[model samples]
Target: MADPTTPPEPNESVSETEIEAPRSRRRGILVAAVVAVVLIGLGVWWHSTYSEDTDDAQVNGHLIQVSSRIAGHVAKVYVDENQLVKAGDPIVDLDPSDYQVAVENAEAALASAKANAAAARVNVPIITINTGSNLRSADADVTGARATVAQAEEQLDAAKARVEQAEANNVKAQSDLERYKPLVEKDVISKQQFDAAVAAAASSKAALADSRASEQAAEDAIRVARERETQAQAMQKYAQTAPQQIAAQDAKAKQAEAQVEQAQAQLDQAKLNLGYTKIVAPADGIVTRKSVEIDQNVSSGQNLMTLVSLQDLWITANFKETQLRRMQAGQAVVVHIDSTGKDYSGRITQIGGATGSVLSLFPPENATGNYVKVVQRVPVRVDFTNLAKEDPNHQLRPGLSVEPKVRVK
Candidate 1:
């Protein structure tokens, strides 16, 4: 040390090399800082050009509502909240006693209708045969009556001819008897001859009377045969309705068959109702918000619970409209879940047709003229490609916050 407080000479101690070394160090530091800034800008530009990222993303999945198809009292509950179930698994069961009884009643009704149809069908042919037989018998009776009338007319004609001959013979016998009487009075004829002549005339007169009676009987027979013919014709007309009777019977059979079909339909409906009493899961999902309980009376179409499908999950990333210029379907994506702190690989499937705000319950009215321009966010759907392998534990759920990056290059 030269002195406690000594001031150094202005240009005696400092070397030119030392001064240049410090200046060089400062220049090197400035150059390094400039290069670092340039590199940082280039990195940022490259990342932005290659990929699009958004923090406004969430896991989305299918939300299924479970309900009852028919009205019944709940008999049993098979699941609790947050229980995983497979498709067709039993979720709830209603009292099936009423449905079973209805099915039984429908079956009985169907059987009865079938029996009635069978009986009606049997009557069709029976009626047809009986009517045909009646018709044939009536036709025969009419023909026979016509033939009997013709025979009676012929007999009447013959009887008339015999009466005429008998009259002629009586006339001749009377003339002969008159002549004999005159001769006997003149004492030129015998009494025996006169008696014989009188006998012959009487017999001829009796024969004429018999012929007249036979003619009357023949006429009466003809009248009776005509009456019989008219009656037979009436019967034939009545029996000719065989087709109508058969058609009526067939119609009845068809009606019974229709009833049978109706009863069968009712039976099928009853069976379906009985099957509906057992409520099963429509898909594989996690049961949540279970609102049904045992012994609860529920009505048709009543909501029972909610089922969340975790296996088929996708990411709904809301990105700025400007970022969608290069974003499109079939692009690779990476999703980072906030809950699991893990990244999942996925692919872009679709983009929403409209902005989320536009699809809201109350859309913005731009026509008010006082509207303020806002950068809208469009929803992009990114479906996980290997969620089954990446999230086997099923930690990711719907509405979970996630960060997704989509590669547009």
Candidate 2:
């Protein structure tokens, strides 16, 4: 509630003095401006003399997708996300029970096939022996039958001679009986003598009958011998088919061998499948995006993680198409990493066939209305040489922002 305006004293005027304050502040600001100008000028001169022409780029490498080759529950995961690994390192282990069972089954099948083959081989000799024995028996029977036929033929010849002799005796006996009867009627001889002659004649006639019966028996024996010989010949014919039997056995053996080979192939396939249970790193790299965990079930070819190979790294620079006029493969380049403030030496490796926008998921339709011309960007790949000598530990990685400069000359 004091008076709004009042006259100031000499002391108050002394406190409010602003004589050279604005001048001092202006001079300080001017000096700062001059120093900034000098630093900028020095920087421009240094860049023009030593710095290389650079374009915005990124570090790129092979992005390998790791997956399971067989279906099983993951028993163990040896690696974690973002972990570094070397080639042949085990990454995931699947339950090997199923594969082991398959291998065992295949092995059993192979053994069985081998046993069958061995058995078939043994049968070869057995069949040969049996066939040989049968043929020998048939041959012996044929020889015996031929001997019997010869013996029967000799007996028949003897019996025929005996029959002729008997017929002549019978003729003599009939003539003697007629003469004795006439003698008895004429009483020229005694009755006893005539009776004796008649008895002798009757006995001779009976002997003739017995000889005829012997000849008939000899003929029947010859027929029997011939029948026996025919039976032996038929048996010999059957025995002579040993070669055909051997051929059939050989075919069976061949079939068994083929089965063995087929089983062996299956065993090999099963072993290969078993090996798939242990998923290992394909190459030396850094692992990322590990999706598998212990006790997790995975199917064949399912994505498990990614491997970024650090052995080979390059830079992908999206340069304006106009800048490509002077760029070519094999040109030396300078790559500067913004993140680490490190410099790398490389060379141009490749150039894209089309612009970046043209390969985009949704490309710009220039035919549509409101088309605004834009400077197209072409991707250029710059590859590093002597990478192992530079960083053997693989410190450089993909997706790192870099500035790369190419020397046209």
Candidate 3:
């Protein structure tokens, strides 16, 4: 053996260039790997610095509950589950026969009330005219009766004067007759003179009787005139109530008008009830959770269906509290829907006022001194900016999972 520790002799086929080629190839691969890693690190840092992403997001929309406003037996159901409907489209129909009858009855009542009011109004003027005429006539009668009583009083005074004159003449004639009787007994004068005295006395007595009769007749006339005056006064007292009667009539007319108004109100209410029998859609949406059926008896405010409005939809993203440092309203957002594998453009509308755990039914209490820190999530509302353009078919529904990315920078 030549030297045990010495190297063996080199072969001529293995050149020095071949030995150096392995080292050069290894160096090229190592340099390329280092460059690739550096580029990837820079790209990741840029993404993290400029944007925020969260998978705790979902699509949300308005879920309107459709119900009956009045109690009735359902006669028709116009929509099925998942059916699209426009605002004011008929959704259900209740039996309208009862409402129709109510409307008819109300109309009849209103007509009756109107007729009564008309009659009462006509009576108002008539009563006023009649009462005014009666009052005027009574006043005229009272005046006339007073004049007749005055005339009767004057006649009574003249009759008394005539009675007094007649009595005086009768006394004088009787004295003369007594003197003639004495002369005739003594035969000192002619009998004709005594006879003349007797005739004068008789005539005077008859005149006195006639005067007394006239006085009695005058008293009777005065009594009759006074009675007429009393009658006239009574008539005036009755006519004095004419104004009160007219007012009462007017009041009756007003009451009738009030009744007419009440009837009109009732008729309007009946018409409204009739309109309520036809249930219509409140907005444009897709019907779901249909619980009403034909011939089913539904009470007032009973749930008939649920209407999901896809036209007004948004995303609710639960973001970590740490991610909200650079987030704010009106920031641009990209929503990736997991169900549809589609991306929608939106903008941040609002951020929650409190964390999800604090808003929960049972919030955690850390005051017991055994506190463990937790990462809390805050709800963020993102409203689509291009919903009409991207989702024309309205396929995005509520409660769909989504991933949202916000460009915070």
Candidate 4:
């Protein structure tokens, strides 16, 4: 212990100490802590800002409805629920009885129509022949009528000549009778001669009457022949439409042919519908939602199930507005699925025009009293690059949560 008033002797190391030393040491430590905190903050900020992360997204694809196009009973269902299928795979079958009967009926109708068409075609020739014969017969009748007219004219000429000769003879007989009677009256002629002259006059008068009757008969024959000619002319006029009759038969044949074509078309349609009874798949896809059962009476336009195309899968990412500022169409993106920790590459195909809420059925109305400012999300469509060929797991499904990232330059 040293005296209280004396200054203590100091060691060299201890003498070098000042009040500022501890402060300096503390300041250096504070500086070093500040530097370390700044570095840590920078590292955390870099991690938060630049580190790649997965975003919440969904895998989507076309959900094609498989329905019956024709009405029938369910015959068979080839696929079950969640059964993977390819394109053009059969899924269901309907009772083909009705369609089969319809096809048969249509076929029979087509046959009948074809038969009728054939018959009509045959009738064309028959009508042609009949019409031609009628026309020829009419021509022959006209020729015969002209001959009869010539014969009647000749007969009328002969009758007129005979009447003229009979008249001259009768006039001469009358003149002789008158002269002879006057002689007899004078008692210069014998009674027998007077009697003979009177008989001759009577004979001449009878001959003239017979000749007039013959002329009247000839005129009547001429009128009868003229009437026959008129009838023949009318018949000829009717026969002039023989060509028209043939044409009409031909037109009937054409109409029958058209009917045959229509019937054939109907038969083809029926056969096609009958084939449709076997519900063959239109393309390669997976079977889903199989609601049809055996012996079920299904009708047309009924929903049987759905088919999801695995090959045509795409990812729909609902990114925030801030995240989408760098995203653009045709940009390459990586998809990380939550179900399977696998990465898939795709390209941005399209972007939704409106926010998800705006497209919702009951969208938020900004004019309402309970309106709140919320961050809107837009859908971005991403198409996988050959997922069906490369992905062995095929884990991507519709409505599955996934993470997507788009690279921007």
Best by lDDT: 1
Ranking the candidates on TM-score from highest down gives 4, 1, 3, 2
Please give, for residues 291-362, the per-residue lDDT of candidate 4 as tens digits. 899999988889998888666789878877776766789888878888888888889999899989989999
Q: What lDDT score is found at residue 180 in candidate 2? A: 88
Regions of candidate 1 where Cα sits further than 4 Å from its true position: 1-17, 117-261
Clashing pairs for model 3 are none
- Comparison by lDDT, 2 against 3, better one: 3
- Candidate numbers sorted by lDDT from highest down: 1, 3, 2, 4
All candidates: TM-score:
0.74, 0.62, 0.70, 0.75
Q: Candidate 2, residues 264-299: lDDT per residue as tens digits?
A: 999999999899999999988989987889999999
Model 1, range 89-149, lDDT digits (tens) per residue?
9999999999999999999999999999999999999999999999999999999999999
- Compose the digit string of candidate 3's lDDT tens values, residues 1-409: 5987755557433567788899999999999889989989998998788989999999999999999988899999999999999989999999999989999999999999999999999999999899889889999999999999899899889989999998999999999998888799998778988889899999999999999999999999999999999999999988999989989999999999999999999999999989999999988899999999999999989999999987799999999999999999999999999888999999999999999999999998878799777899999999999999999888898999999999999
lDDT of each: 0.94, 0.88, 0.93, 0.85
Which candidate do you rate higher for TM-score, 2 or 4? Answer: 4
Q: Show where candidate 2 strays beyond 4 Å.
A: 1-57, 119-260, 318-328, 352-379
Best by TM-score: 4
